[model samples]
Target: MKRIFTFGVLAVALASTVVLLAGCGGGGEEETAAIGAVKVPFWHAMGGPLGDALDELVLEFNATHPEIEVESISMGRYQALSQKIMAAVAAGEPPVLAQAYEAWTGELIENGSAEPLQGFFDGPDGLSEEDLADFVPGMLDNNTWDGVVYSFPFNKSVRALYLNKNLFEAEGLTRAPATWREYEDMARRLTKDTDGDGEIDQWGTAGQISAWMFENLLIQNGGQILTDDGKHAAFARSEGVEALEFMVRLLTKYGKVTSGYEYQNDFQAGKVGMIEGSTVSLSFMEGKYTFDMAVAPLPAGKQKGCFVAGTNVVIFAEAKQQEKEAAWKFIKWFTSPDVTARWAAKTGYVPVRMSAIESEAMAARLDEVEGLREVLAQLEFASYEPRSAAWYAGRKHLEEGAVEGALRQILTPKEALQGSAEAVEAEFLGVVPM
Candidate 1:
């Protein structure tokens, strides 16, 4: 889940830095059209093919729009982008637009650094009711806070279970598991010591200690990360314990524990039979391996649940009015049905709009990709993590303290979760004035 971003230190750093730009103005906005092409600088952490796809879209946008030019600046990784954004905001010179995680958007909103986008959405050149209805509700909801739209979902992805189909066929398994029970049974059966060296080389499944994965399992078991009031932690309860215990059983009894992207490498190398990964991972594994693969919705627990992942596009309040206008125009254009569909088709990301999912571009992609249709179908039940800035640190605590502690046998699941809950509660108290 800590793909290209690590937030533990950056989250704390951003809290102190973002507030420094409060009440800062973007200066006068008189007759700026005479200055030629209002430049809107966009800071992002998209590299590799993802970055290439985004740059292509930006080029297309610039080529068609003579009056507005968007400068897409690559920050290489989210951690560096986050640090640079905080430093820029503190210096009163933030970019016009940036890709922001939910927690970062929350921090920016709290400090008055983010421009509330609802106004633009309701403006003269705004989206129509039909245009608004095109977006996937959950994806749109992720960008709205306190009943106000503050950003727009960008490069969104959902967790999907990736299965090594060749291995499945070897075991005479016809399809992916439909339930946690079936998943566990298949994991047990798929694990093997092919060389007979008394050491198992092939695992049924593998995963890193991930708060993202844990969040999906928690929701599947009817648990929430925070209380309904959104003021305290709720993951120490029975539901959470059950979720962690299941993960522990999978790693210790049936699978192996990994760190960072080792699980992904293992899965690709055919050393692991299955893995829970982002839909975007398909782009990374497309033609690298010889084995047949399949992607499916995460196996159900007590109920169906999937947590949406990735950042959103937010415009800064400190940018000039003209720059902000240009940023909005680009955001609007980029998220349109056809544009989003094209982005998803080229990058393996899920389109934020339902119309985009049904568009010809995505339909062609689905026909070409093996398991993408099922992956996109997960959007129907997808939800997002807490938008509270406290969760930026809270998730790190969950992964390192609760998840790792339990997986390493250093603490019982209950004890590990209780510790994480107490830590997150402390963060909420520190970040928000109770």
Candidate 2:
């Protein structure tokens, strides 16, 4: 909420330092037949309060800039955005910027649909080498490919367990779980069908069981999900089987939670005692239910892990010079220490800049929640989703593959994991490393 951007209106004076300037120059570029206006389209996936906040940000951008115009269109989450983008590109109208996941970002750059923005570091008043150091360590590496940073991380979310404090207290549970075994022990105590209807009326833990979530949990349990190269699947190993067996035990043995209810809805409605989801869940959850809510870090395994989740800013390859410059200016403010501090405080996505997270504002906000301090502490051990085309093109198959083994009582945990791993391996048959 703090305006760290000073309105000096300094023109981009230096050119060569500007790394990705395919078409840049302040007043030196050729003028179009149109007068003093450039249209830059953006596609983003956000809804509810955070979406409203983004709309306000777009208005702020429009109000401040005279030469460039930004239009942020809503494209739903991963599934919806991918469909919309594919259709738009086929129709010859891709947006200037996109809000996509790390997997999608990798595919965009691989398909020549996106360009690296690292040159922004060298441009006139672009991100400095020191500025680069201010960023949260794992963010850029998550979105980068082949030695180049492809996406500019704007907002980030990480895995966290949103526990219903009232429920925990009612069940004599005083604290959140720190390790997988602890989580399992607590979940069993919390699961009970109060009505004796033979069906579960309450659950101790819930989440969408998929490959990525599998990777998140498995890695937490001392497992390696992807190969060293980041292109191949490595889930068929002992580590992978151990991870799947752990989750399968949750559904089959513990009976903590069912998969039918939407993750946030059930959590917010009070039927769910514990749910793991994006930190952005806080935005929708503001003032919803007045219960003692506290956040716990994603439970750790011997390996220690949580996936970095968020959107990044990207400039198109042939965008207008004025548009690119304007975008960079907004990005500078968006990613700055003070601005990101306020943003993380308002929206719940952890700031991707280390300085922003440490700023006094964030510290004060943490003092208020106090419980979230552990989540911030978990940043030191976060991991990235494996970047790949198969991940983008065929994540659902993996999801179904995982959910199948997890929900059914028929397959042993090892059997489920082996089948799921084989399925993912089949999908990665011909991926050439970049």
lDDT of 1 by residue, 33-149 (tens): 235788888899999889888888887887778788777788999899999998999899999999999888888888799999999989976898998888887777778877899
Model 2, span 235-276: residue lDDT tens: 656776777777777645554334543656777778778877
RMSD of 1: 9.9
Sequence-dependent TM-score of model 1:
0.89
RMSD to the true structure for each prediction, in A, is 9.9, 11.7
lDDT of 2 at 274: 82
Clash list (residue pairs), candidate 2 = 17-122, 18-123, 19-119, 220-301
Model 2, total clashes: 4
Tell me how candidate 1 scores on lDDT: 0.87
